[model samples]
Target: MGVVNVTPDSFSDGGEWFEPDAAVRHGLDVLAAGADLVDVGGESTRPGAERPSVEEELRRVVPVVRALAAEGAVVSVDTMRAEVARAAVEAGAAIVNDVSGGLADESMVPWVAHAGLAFVAMHWRGHSTSMQSRAVYDDVVADVCRELAERRDALLAAGIRQDLLVLDPGLGFAKTAEHNWALLAALPVLHGLGHPLLLGASRKTFLGRLGRHPGEPLRPPAERDVETTATSVLAAMAGLWCVRVHDVASTVRAIAVVEAAMEHAPEEGPA
Candidate 1:
């Protein structure tokens, strides 16, 4: 999966693709670079961000989704609104990637079920403005898995097909850097939930903070591709279903190598 933020305030590459033409071009670029899906989001979900008006979100996202899907790129609307998702589907989106996991909008789950679109249900605690305060957890991995399972059950109960649902741990949504790392290490445990997993650790703040000296500035989001690629490689090795990334080509190449290496590994256990 590749990320295409159509808003002016996403944590990374926001205004860079705010224009429909530019976003469409970017969508094509990522697809050519080997992304199986292009995720187009209008609203910024960065911590402390405010919600965009539904009208503004629809205006921002529908055209890009329409253009990208027309060009034959598989498109996922990264929205938490049923209205936007409905319009994007009408415009040609095949999947709805909701960060709120049907919790943000009351109408989201039923609408998704009615449309029969594939849904990426991320584990979310609250909206961006206050979500960070909700990061509390007894055990990050177990809590995330338990919450995700609750979401999965709710989504299924709302009429979404079990197979069409994909789980995302909401990597940086309400998580501290340590929490994100812990979840990364527990990818297999997340997979134990009986659903395919989507990992979106690409260029996130946690990756940006890695290895930085005390009092030094964190790595810029655009410069975190190296860490993003490494994490994507690890996630792939851990049986992740997909990785939402800003830099798709490099991760694609790395995963290809991983696949090739796995193909030729000896049958005996390493130990």
Candidate 2:
């Protein structure tokens, strides 16, 4: 996966692709660079970021979603609003990657079910503005699993097919740095829920804080590809179905190595 943020306030590459034309170009470039899917987000979920209104989100995403879908690339509209998601799918987006996991908007789940779209339901506590203050958890892994299970149940009740859903362990949302690492390390726990997992730790703050360099405070988002790939490999090892990443080529390369290793594992058959 490759990320294309059309919002000017995204944490990593905020203003880079804020314009529709630039976002489309970036999406095409990422696809050319080997991204199996392009996740186009109109709202920035960055910590402390201000949320954009539904109208603004729609204006930013619809064109890009339509264009990318027309170009034959798998397009996922990264949104939390049911109205926006409804318009996006009509415009051609094939998937909904909602960071709020149906908590932000009441109609999101019904829209997802009605459209029969692939859904990426993320673990979230609140909007970016107040999420940091709500990052309290006794056992991070258990909390995340419970929250995701609740969302999954809601989706099922809303008439969503089980196979159309994917669960994302919202890396930085309502998760302290340690909490993020705990979730990453305990990915098998989430997988045991029997749902396909989508890991979205690319260029996130936790990746930047990993084992600091000798003379560096911490690598910025632009410089965290190697660290991101390290976690990508770990995610692959955990048997994750897909990884949502900004650095597409490197993550793909890392998964390739992991996949090859798994394919060649020595084993006894029917012994």
Candidate 3:
């Protein structure tokens, strides 16, 4: 998966693709770079970011989704609103990548079930503006797993098909740098949930913080691609089903290397 943020305030690469034409082109480029799908998000969910109205989000993403789908590219609409999901699906999105896990909108789960599109249920504590305050966790990994499991069960009860659901630990949503690292290290625990995992740690603030020194500025988002690619390689090795990233080409190459390594690994003999 590749990220295409068509908003002016996404923590990374926000206004760079805010224009429909630019966003569409970037989606195409991502697909060309070997991404299986492009995730187009109109709203910026960066910590402390304000929400955009439904009309504005629709205006931002619908056209880009339409254009990409018209070009035969698989597309996912990254939105919390059922209305926006509905419009994007009608416009050509094949998946709904909701960061909120259906918590933000009452109509989301039912709509997704009716549409029968792939739905990504990320572990989210609250909306971006207030989520940072909710980051406290006794055991970040265990707590995140519990919350994600609850969301999965709820969605199942809401009529969403078992196979249509994907789980994301939501690397940065309401998580501290330490929490994000813990989640990544606990990928096997998360995989034990019996659902395909979608890891989206691309260019996140945590990666930037990893390169920072005490009292020094964190590395910018673009500079974190190296670390993001490392995460991709680890995720692939851990059997994650997909990784959402901005620098798709490099990640694609990294995953290829992982695949090749696995393919040629020595087989166990009478172990």
Query: Which residue window of length 10 is worst by lDDT in model 2?
Result: 210-219
lDDT score of residue 224 within candidate 1: 96
lDDT of 2 by residue, 1-271 (tens): 7999998877788589999999999999999989999998898888788888888999999999999999999989899899998898888888899999888999888878887888888998999989999999989999899888988898888888899889998889988899999998898899867789999988898788778866678778988899889888999999988998888989888889999999999887895
RMSD of each: 1.4, 1.8, 0.9
Model 2 clash count equals 0
* lDDT per residue as tens, model 3, 1-271: 9999999987887599999999998998899999999999999998999999999999999999999999998999999999999999999899999999999999999989987778999999999989999989999999999989999999999988999999999998889989999999989889878899999999998888884688899898988999999999989999999999999999999999999999999999995
**Stretches > 4 Å off in candidate 1:** 268-271
Superposition TM-score, candidate 1 onto the true structure:
0.97
User: Best candidate per TM-score, number?
Assistant: 3
Better of 1 and 2 by lDDT: 1
RMSD in angstroms, candidate 3?
0.9
Against the true structure, what is each candidate's TM-score? 0.97, 0.95, 0.98
